[model samples]
Structures are given as structure tokens and as C-alpha cells.
Target: MSTIDPTGVTLVIGATGTTGSRTVAQLTAAGRPVRAASRRAGPLPGAEPVRFDWYDPAGFDAAVTGADRVYLVPPVGDPDPAAVMLPFLDRARAAGVRRAVLLSSSAIAEGGPAVGRVHRALPGLFDEWAVLRPSWFMQNFTGTHAHADSIRADGAVLTAAGAGRVGFVDADDIAAVAVRALTDDRAPNADLVLTGPQALSHDDIAAILTDVTGRPVVHHHLTYEAQRDRLAAVIPPEFAAMLAGMDRDIAGGSEDRTTDTVRRLTGRPPHGFRAVAERELGAPAASAAAVHPESPTGAGSGGRLR
Candidate 1:
């Protein structure tokens, strides 16, 4: 397998976020130089913090400067992020950035939606490029996302997905694939559809959470319009509609498939939902009885795509 030069630095956008943070950590742990970009530019172990904001282009040049490769995470909650993202990407390309790896959703496709437009433009901007179309992140239910908030407050997971199943993937696995795509001697040069080992319904997720946390978590189904309205309360109405439509599509079996992309790329099996729960939620080893004494969980509620 051909490899890219490991001497160049990598700029990680959204460095404080779920996948971005992990990507930065992994890159740095591998003895690679990383410029971690975020609004606050907060400190991360083994990374150089750089202040960056998509809406503000003043810092864009500095963020891309000295970096040869970049990991892209579009600004969250913006209905049309391409408007701002495209300009910065052009700047990065001109500033000597060569490789780019974008974090996109499995529900979206090239030229399909928000980040999809970016996915379509990536190849034209950089000769070395990859788009990581990862399934809904398992971090959504563990981090500060709406699903996790509701679970902590009311012990319920809300969604319009009904009984449909999704191949929920862990954010760590997404980051692992991203690191490979960025640093590998060869750029993926293609969109990678990432998913965990198996498909799981929301009920299975709730049961896993209930067992792990010992808090009796449950899935609370809602109508499409209701889900949209609920999400609109916090995010833009258009973005909220888009998110609810994903749920509607889920109910139609759109996200029911799984992929071996993670294992194929990372050289190991992806983590299961139960395993993610046990690790992220601090579940004891005894709580592994939730899934027939065997298995192992991403998104089920209103949250920004990260």
C-alpha cells in the first residue's frame, strides 16, 4: 500500500467536537503534528490549538497556513453550510493544503444536501480527498446531545423513526477511519460509507441504555411534524425539517443497511452499541446482559449533525 508523506501537518476543524477531537487525539498520538481548530481554540493534549470560525474568514488563512492536510467538519445547525464552507476551502487549497477528509452523514450523498455539496466539491479542490459518510454517531446518545439530555432528564429517547433500524456507528470508529484517510499513503479518493457491525432499532438501543445505566430508558415515538416542530424549537426551521425528514426516511428503511467500511479501513471490527454504552456511559461489566448476553448503539433525537 502506498503512503503519503508523514512529515506534513494536519489541520483538524471542529477540534472540540465528537469526531474532530478524537481525530486530533489519534493523529497526535501517532506522532503527527496537528493544528486543532475551534472557536475557543481551547487546549488539547499534544495538539496546537488554533482559533477558527466558518462564518468569520479572518482566521481562516491562519488556520490553513502550515497545514498540508485537513479534516473537515462543517459548521453545525446551518441549513446551507456550503455558502460559507466553500470559500474557506478555496482559501485552504490556495494556501497549500493538499488533502482533505470530510465528515458527512450516511443519510446524505454527493450533491444531496448541506455537507453533500462540500463532498461534491472536495475532489475538485484537492487531488487527494475523501468523504467519510458515517452513520449516525453513537456519541449523540452519550455526549451533550438532545437524546442524551432527554435520557438523563426523563429517561426517554425521542424520535419519529418508529420501529426502523439504523446501523449506528461510534464516533471513535469514524475518527479512526478519518485518520486513515488523512494520513494513509493513499487518499481514499472515494466516499466511504461507515457503519458499525450490525443494524439496531431504537428499542434495542433503549433496552441497552436501560440495562447499562439502570435507569429504565425508553423510546418515545412521535409524528414527523411533531419531531420537526420539537427540533425547530432549538435549530432553524429548515434544518429541523431536514432532520425530521431523515427520521421519516429511517422509518422507510433508508438507513437499515450496515457496511464493513470501518473494518475494511481500520483493520478491525467497529465497536457495537452496547460496547459504546459500557465505555461512554460507564456501565459495569455486569450490565452486559442487555443483548442476549452477547452484543452491544448513534442518533435518535433532535441534535445538530457533527
Candidate 2:
């Protein structure tokens, strides 16, 4: 528990999603008030649920009302989220929101792509703010995410990242950092690069999966063009291309480094890939042990990434 009780009602956007949910849980556990905002307003144990949508401006007033801090999860599929989010943030600032925290990717930079646009303008928008640029998530391998079903069925993880290693950060660590940032009196008014303790390649991920799940999971490396083509069918062409390029960068060692931001913020080192795999996937794979298929991986549902 924090020695200082952080002030204000925190308005958490995407409260039902990955990092947001965990953030809300931590704040409530700390005895801080939270305004949980989502597309669907649902009952929460220690929060005030409000209906919210980034595309809908009508809800902005109620969402930010009496809320001094916000945890922003910009709408996905908007190639440029700044246009939609900036106006809302302006309204939020006008309504007395003093701090904000954005969920961004390690691959994104100022004006680069996706959350990068928001990242560039964050410091100027709010007096106290932080943009979390996290590497790939470990949840991708355990939950019903882009790679989960494929791994369950095919015993394989397809990637354009040939042998590029990534320090896959756990979502729980991200939530811990976010909650601290949201309520901290002295803001970390900077872009924080978060990662796990060590980096591992897709082949390494497969080996861990095999050991945990007791299945012969392997990594199928694809060419950039091939990977882009595969993703294009599910997501927009431009988005698919961007994702493929990210993979290409990964393959080139862009995300090989690890950071201590997680430990710095949460006062503990991050969970290693193998540890996360064991905690989240080991139990499930053991209950239903069987030989899986060999299906080619494709983007599934274009799920909202945190």
C-alpha cells in the first residue's frame, strides 16, 4: 500500500480491458475512488461506472465530470487517434482533469503510428502525465488473444520476426505502474519504456510453450510481405502494413532491450517470460492435454490492444 493516499476520483477509460481493469482493481484496493468508464456501464465493487466511447463526444462531459485524473486507452482502428482524443482531452482539461496516463506501445514514437500521435502531445496537454510504451504482452500467449487460439489449435506461433527477441512484459506489471502513475502526487511527466527482465525470440517462446503445455509448439517465420498479406485480410491494408513493419523492426532487434521502469515504479523486478507462462498457461494446458493442429496464424478480430 502507498504511504500517501493519492487524491481525486480517477476516471479510467477502457476500464473493462486488460490494463485498465487491473488499474481499477489496484486503485480500489488502495481505497481510492475510481470512475470506471467503458462502452458498457456495469456495476463495480468500488467504482462509479459510466458509459463512455471515444467516438461519442456526448459522454465526455459525464466521463470527466468530478474526475481529476484519467487513464486513457485510445480507440483502436483510428489510424490517427489524436484527432478523436485531443478534442476530448481538451474538454477534460477544461473540466479540471489534472493528470492523464496513456497506454502506448514500445514500437510507437512521436508521430510514428497509432498511440505515438497521442504520446507526442501528452506532455503539453496535461500538467502531469505519462505515456507507457510497453513491449509485447505475455497475455498474448495465455489469454484469448491474437496468438492464444492459434497456439492452442496449431501448436505453433507464426511471426515475421525471424529471431528477434522481445522482453515480453506481463500485463499485471503494467497495471501496477499505471495505478501508481494515476494517483502519484508527483507525476512521472515522461514517456516510460517498460519491459520484462529478459528478452526471448519466438523460437524461445515456442520452447517455453512446449515445456509448459507439453505440446510441440514451434515458430513459423514468414516474410514481411507474406505476413502483411495474411493480416491484410482481417485488418485494414494500411494497419496490416504497419503491423508487418513492426514485425520487421522486431526481427532487426528493435525490442531486444529490457528496462527497469517496472521495478522503479512498482518496487519489484518484472516477471520473466517463463514465469509468466507457467503461472498463466501451465495449469490450463495440463487440464486438457492433447495434440494440436498445424493451422497458419492470421489476425483474429483485430482485438483492442492495450
Candidate 3:
């Protein structure tokens, strides 16, 4: 739908992820060809699935072939995504790829965190590039993460972000923005902060879940050390500490903000926390949680808060 040929394949990295899957669906529905790249590429609804891994260079050429655009998901756990992505980006540029969209977190800045490094370098690598700095995904509450299990089993949501609010955005909304970023004739060429329509505290979230699920849900506020210790059982200690630190920052109201970028870019409003809760929790607990990846927040992300 851009100036580029409509038939030119768009390489979608992490094609089966939270946002990636939705992006692929939207693009394909619009009659665009897509190369859905992932570690275990399988049959998708309307695209070609191809095996691709960021750490593997040998798989890059096949995925990039005849592709004019790409959606990037930086390698998690890698301190420098640029090291892993820059080479492939150069290769894509040489192969006539014209646009790129990188998925980043709102908490990460242009020169700050791991994705931030990639965000700073996006423009220079490709003339048309947009960085999506989305806030913590609402999926963290419904999907396979530290919160979902406890929420399902104990009817409780735990966080160190006591009373601190977050403008949790929906993954589907993020995907719609990605589709535009990859297909629009003119790129925004800037870092866009994506959020839900409103901000809500963890307590508000628990209340919403309780109302929607008709279950007695409670918000269990944990100390920073306790949050870190709980996560340490699953992920690395250093990473758990890092997540706890971010949670502490949240307690200070770090993520209590909303934006209109989603509506401005996608011609639709982002999903509110209430809407997310109703739709996700409106279903049976097991069914709703099954909609997410096995582990939406392990490591290599901002924190389990994501």
C-alpha cells in the first residue's frame, strides 16, 4: 500500500508474538505479501511462514529476499541488540529493503535501555523507520507471566507498584500501529509512545478483574525485594533485581501517563484497561490466559511488568 510494490514481501520478525501475529493478520488482510519469520514457523492464516532467528545469520538472506520492509523485535537478554541487528539491517538495506519498524518499550529511551540503542540507530540504517515505544502490555495480566498464574490460582495480582498508575496498552493496538508504520507511504521517523486511553493503578486492575470475572480478586502489594525474590525463582537473579528496581520506579509513578499516538496513527483509539479486562477476563480463566505466549516476561524485557 506504500510507494513500494504491494507484492514485495514484508519480513515480520517474531511473527507469532503478541503484536507480531496481529500485524501479520492485518497486512495479509490488506492483500500484502508477508514473510512470517520465527523460530518455529508454522502455517498462518494468510502468509508464508519461514524459519528465522535473529542470532542466526545464515537464515537472514532467505527471509530478506524480495522484501521491501521489515518488523524488528530485538533479541531479548542481549545487552546490545544493535550488535545482532545492525549486520542484518545492513544486509536488508543492500537487498533493497526500504522500511523498518522496531518494537520498543515506552520506558526505554533513544539512548537508554537495550531497545533504546536500536531505536537511536533505526533512522540511520533505513530512511523510513518508526520506533514503537509501547508501555507495559495488558497481556502481562492475562498472559503467561508472573502475574497471570497468581491471578488465576489465587485470584490475586501482585506488584511492587503500590498505587502507582500505568497506562497499559493492548498488544492488538500496538500491532495496528506496526502495520501502518511498515505500509504507510511516509514514515513518522520518530519514537512514538503508545499507551491505553487511561492510566490505572494495580488496585484498579484487580477490581476490574474481579468485576469482569465475578471472582474475588485482590491486589497484593509486594515489597521491591519480595517481587525480585519471587521472580528470581524463575529468571536470573540479576534480571529479577532489575525488574524489581523498575517496579520501585513504577511505585514512584514512572509509568502513569497516556497518549493519543495510537488513535493519531491508526485512526482508532487504543484499548482502555477496562476494555482489556472485560475482553480478556470475560472469557474463562484458562481460555483467556491461553491467548498469550508461554512466557511474555521472562528476561530481556523491561521487567515482568511487561
Q: Each candidate: what lDDT?
A: 0.86, 0.83, 0.81
Candidate 2's TM-score: 0.92
Better of 2 and 3 by lDDT: 2
Where model 1 places Cα greater than 4 Å from the true spot, the runs are 1-4, 283-301
C-alpha positional error of residue 81 in candidate 3 after TM-score superposition, expressed in Å: 2.8
Reference-based lDDT, residue 220, model 2? 94
Full candidate order by TM-score, most accurate first = 1, 2, 3
Q: Model 3: runs farther than 4 Å from truth?
A: 1-3, 284-306
Would you list the rank order by lDDT, best first? Answer: 1, 2, 3
TM-score of each: 0.93, 0.92, 0.90
Clash counts per candidate, in order, are 5, 0, 1
- Best candidate, lDDT: 1
Model 1 residue 134 distance off true place after TM-score fit, in angstroms:
0.6
Two-way lDDT contest, 1 vs 2, winner: 1
- Lowest-sum lDDT 10-residue window in model 2: 295-304
lDDT of 3 by residue, 63-170 (tens): 898899999987655556778888999999998898899998887789876667778888898878899999888887766555766766677777788999999899
Question: TM-score of model 3 relative to the true fold?
Answer: 0.90
In candidate 3, how many Å is residue 230 off?
2.2
